[model samples]
Target: MRVIVVGAGEVGTNIAERLQDAHDVVMIDRDRERVESITYDQDVLALEGNGTSLETLEEAGLERADMVIASTDIDETNVVICGAAKAMDDAFTIARIKRTNLLRTWERSEEAFGVDFMVCTDLHAAEAIVDIAGLPGARDVDSFANGLVRMAEFDVKPTSPIAGETVAEADRYESLTFAAILRDDDVVIPEGETVIQPHDAVVVIGSEESVREFAGSLTPAPTLEQANEVVVVGGSEVGYQTARLFEAAGLEPRLLERDPDRARELAERLPQTLVLQSDATDIDFLVREHVDESDIVVAALESDEKNLLVSLLAKRIGVGRTIGVVEYGEYADLFETVGMDVAINPRLVTAEEITRFTREHRTEKLAMLEHDRAEVLEIEVDADSVLCKTRIREVMADLPEGVVIGAVTRDGELITPRGETVLEGGDHVVVFVDTEVLDEVAAAL
Candidate 1:
């Protein structure tokens, strides 16, 4: 694939990094520093020019690009870039925008805004938060096989019940597959006797019910349905979207906005959400509203610092869980380390969405894990494919060491892979591949 990525910010840079190993990538940015930095750090051509300009697109070889991605921070600029790129070539175009309104407009028609695909950053981040909220003790969650199969990453705390158990002991769930254990810089493909240590990010893929049961065994907290008390501390777009999604899930979440006009608008827009016009930093206001009694507190203020402060306050006030919306991707680990149960970065979420779209035709679905250290891919088996009609035990010898068959679905039914199981054509298989051998696994499977 020959890919041209506009805007060398976090989202664009991440997309470029993910595709550089397998595709010919070109990146464009108006900032000289960003261009130089990406040129130094990645194996791609970096051009310092306005991406929306025709001459700049030509200079970046847009005529030959297989895909063009517009990912500038500004929503209008990204749309303009995609429009310009689409007017030139037959390349697949993707745009990243922060507003849900723009996405709704694009969905009204085919190839709207000249973009083949669009990813809304704020909405994606909010959805990520809601997904994490539903599964207790899960640091990250993504669904595959049309939501029939689920993948969850749990940070095993020292006090967690399964922290010291072996993989065999923890394999109590019927339809679950222990995909990988992320221990520091290493991606460990666990065996039956492999011990799950504290601080290990354990990745599991399986049926929705089995995954939820495994999540329940990890922590004592109830699921989002059982624990309906959720407080959203901000009226920012992400916060508003988060509250709306929770409401759609049959939850009446509380939203706090400092500005009176914004609070009134939110109250009118979100009928199910309880909108309170008060500064979230005020201890008196939180106590008066009974925020301390909430099961989940979401910090989605305008700035990362403010969100961090609110998350810390929520923790101090005895909230069961805290989900912080992090503007900067680098601060995600920092927020999690400082007691935030989950840190959702909108840019990273947008990048992941766009990356998944890029793999649409080849793979049914894709989920990147541990910042692209590994990926979970859903691929349909065909007669000519290597996995077709193959027994699981025999197929394992041909696959690389890091590849794991997580789940299989046929006729809309879950088929857990085992040593003696044989796969057939038309079956969908969810696979976990270490990024180091992703290309090899993709070819073999």
Candidate 2:
């Protein structure tokens, strides 16, 4: 497939690189330096032009392109490019929109603009923060079906009760599956006799109910609590979006904005949150707002330096946890040194989400597996497929290279199938496939 990606910034470059392995990708940007850099380093077509213009789309051969992805830093440009592409051909149009208001408004009538998909960077970043906040101990989380099923990574501490338990004992938890164990640099595929030691990172999959049960069985359960009081510095779209996420997760959010009218508007838009018209740098104001008692302090101001400064202040003042949103990807590492718990780059996050959604076509949803080189895909099997009539073990032998059935779901029931388990018609099968043979696996199914 031919794909055209607009904006050669972090998001555009990442998307082009990801799709290049599967599709003929072309990346465009207004900056000559960016275009030259990506063209020389990556195996993708890079063009220098104003992508939002119709002439540029024509030059990029949009009519023959299977998909057009507008991931420019500017939301308006992305929307305009996507609109132009859709006007030319309705194949598939995706835009990376950063403004929260635009997304909320567009979502109400997205079909009218012929937008096939909308990627909201702020929303994606907020969701990631919310997930980490909800599961404070989890290093990473991947949710399916909007959170019905989740796979989480928990670091096994030295004080954990089950530190030295074997995998067999751990699997006895009714709803849990001990997926894999990450010990330092190695990832162990556990068997019945495999023993887990202290500092081992364990990945588990199950419904929320079962996962909670599994979490409780650990020697020392990690803390999971909603933030009663939250502090958000900076009134950027990312900040507002994060505030909204906190409110939705039942956190009492207090936003600190420098502009009074903007703060008032934010207060009106997010009635659940208390928007205070005060400079985040004002230590007296922060103290008066009881920043010391806040459960979480999020630094999402425009300047990375400002965010770091505010976060450091919040941490020193005794906030439970501090998260900073870094606009520049290179500054991400500095957040950890400065005491911020997590540093999120919305552009990087949005790029990754868009790449995952666009690179693969067969599956409705795709998630990264234990190894970054592999993927776990949920595909709906055709009713009359031959594999549906055969036992899972037999089908495994005939599966295209690099694919293995991980699990299957029929009528909302999840089943871990063995050789004897038969695949029924209308089943949603979760298959793990190496990146190389994804297409072949899809064809086989």
Candidate 3:
């Protein structure tokens, strides 16, 4: 597919690189130096001009482009570029809008701009932070296309029943597939004889039913529990956004702010939550609020140091989970080192959303990892496909490299699948294939 990316910042660069493997990508930036850098470094077509200009877009062959992504740091520029592209070809268009108000407008009136998709980075990041804050035990949660399928990463405890079981034995379960094992820093694709060891971070991909079965198979199981009481430190925009998502998810949250007026305003805005006018740095205030009873404490103050300090204090006060929202990317490692359950940078999250919206066709959202460059997608068995009526084991050698069937869904039931499992028409097969080989994998299936 022919694609045009309007921006050369971190987000644009990421989108360009991701699509370059399988599509003809043209990247544009206002900075000549940045354009030259991308052109030489990535071997991609780069043009230096205002992407919002129609002449500049036409010069990049926007008429023949299948997709045009507007991801400039400036929200207005992104909107203009997307609007221009939509007017030009009515092609798939995505815009990265960062302002909270613009997001609200986009949600209420997306059709007016002719945008195929709208990604609000701050909102996505806030949602991710809320998920991690709410469920600290999950190492990672990858929601697939509209949340139909989910891949969760969790550590195998020492007491897990299947700790020593081989891959083939584990696959005997009708549901759940052991996608991949992350041991230390290396990723291992397990085979039949491969054994799972304790402390291994395993990625499990399946439908909700299959995932539940997989989680239950462990001796020391992991369960998603609702937080009876949650506390969020700071009443900033991100903090308010995080609290809103938690409340929508049926969790009770208490928001603490230093200013009484701001607290009152937030209290009115979020009537479902309790708003306290108190400084989060005040240990006495936190203790007085019964922080011990809080299941999760999220530190989302504007200052990174304050967020980190409050998170540590909350952890020390017996809060079951602590999450900190750090704006600076450099502070991410610090939060991880201090044992914060999760730390999110809004810029990175927004960049990822833009990248996903820009890149199309190789994999559906359900097969791709959250914020991952490559994807593992699921494809339904078509009547004319080469994989039909064949046993999985027999066809393994003929399959393209970097692609493997992870699981199969038939008649609304999930299966781990084995070599003897025969491909049947209408089966939804989950295959882990590199983006480069996605077309080959699709053709084979």
Candidate 4:
């Protein structure tokens, strides 16, 4: 596949790095230093030019490319580039738009923008946050099988239903399956004899309905209206989007902005949300506003240091959950270690979304779990594939130590795989595998 990527920033560079080995990648950027840096660090053709220009797209061989991805930081520029690319060829076009309204306009009718798909970093991150935030103990949640199936990660509490039960004893749900457990730093691929322990981070896969039922049974029922209490700190696009999503979901979320002008604008834009003008990093102001008493505190500040400090202060003041946006990928782990319940990096999230397009299998969906420790893939079984017409027991034995098939879809029905279950061609299977064994699992399948 010939992929012409516009922009050589973090997200574009990541997409290029992942696709270079599999696709013919050509990256365009106006910054000579960024182009040179990507050229030296990655095996991609780095072209320094204005991506929105017709001549630049032509220079990057847009006519022969299979796909053109516009991922510049500016949403308008990306939309223009995709529209321009479409005029040249019928290549699949994807545009990364940060603003939700612009994204919605293109999504309603792509003819004007010529965008086949849209990736909104702010909206996606906010959705991710809402998925986990609404769930009491959940750290991450991703859906597959067109929202019928879900992979959820959360810590096992002492009062959890499955905490003291072995896998066999806990196999009460018809669709729920325990995929893996993270104990300390080790990822345990559990079996029937494996016992779930308290504080251990567990990953579960099942139909959306059944998984939510199982989750409710595992943890104490959240207080009525508890999920609606949320405090968002930051006036950035990501922060505003998060507040918007929460408000749309019937939650009157409070938004804090250090800039009075931005606060006023947000108040007008989002009448459902409580917009306050104040620095979130100030512990006195946070306490005065009772921010720490909220169900969740989200730090979407521009600087990583501010986010870290705000989250730490929130945690110290007894916020039920603290989520921070880590500007740098390297600081994500540190943020989590220091007390933030979840540290999300927009660049990494965007990269993960793009990776679904580069898979070697018939992957309908893909998501990174446990901070990239494992990957959840919804892949279809080809007629001639090794996995076709295989017994579940033998297939499990043949698979590597860190991989497991969580669910199978046949004829639009979800199937929970057992030892004697036989998998046939045309079945869509959802598998959870450690990052190290992803290649082996793909090869075996």
* Each model's lDDT: 0.91, 0.75, 0.74, 0.85
Q: How many backbone clashes does candidate 3 have?
A: 0
RMSD of 3: 3.7
lDDT (10s digit) by residue, model 1, range 51-158 = 999999999899999999999989999899889988889899999999999999999987888998889999999999999999998988999888999999999989
Show where candidate 4 strays beyond 4 Å: 53-59, 155-174, 182-188, 194-200, 209-225, 380-390, 394-401, 410-413, 424-427, 437-440, 443-445
- Lowest lDDT sum, 10 consecutive residues, model 1, at 353-362
Question: Candidate 1 at 176: error in angstroms?
Answer: 0.6
lDDT value, candidate 4, whole model: 0.85
Task: Return whichever of 2 and 3 wins on lDDT.
Answer: 2
Which clashing pairs does model 2 show?
161-219
> Model 2 — which ten-residue stretch has the worst lDDT?
218-227
Error of 3 at 233 (Å): 2.9
**Span of 10 residues, lowest total lDDT, candidate 4:** 219-228
Candidate 3 lDDT, 216-314, residue by residue in tens: 565222233545788889998888888888778776689999989999999999878999999998888888889877877888888988998898888
What lDDT score is found at residue 114 in candidate 1? 94
Off by over 4 Å in 1: none
For residue 260, what is the lDDT in candidate 4?
90
State TM-scores per candidate.
Answer: 0.98, 0.84, 0.83, 0.85
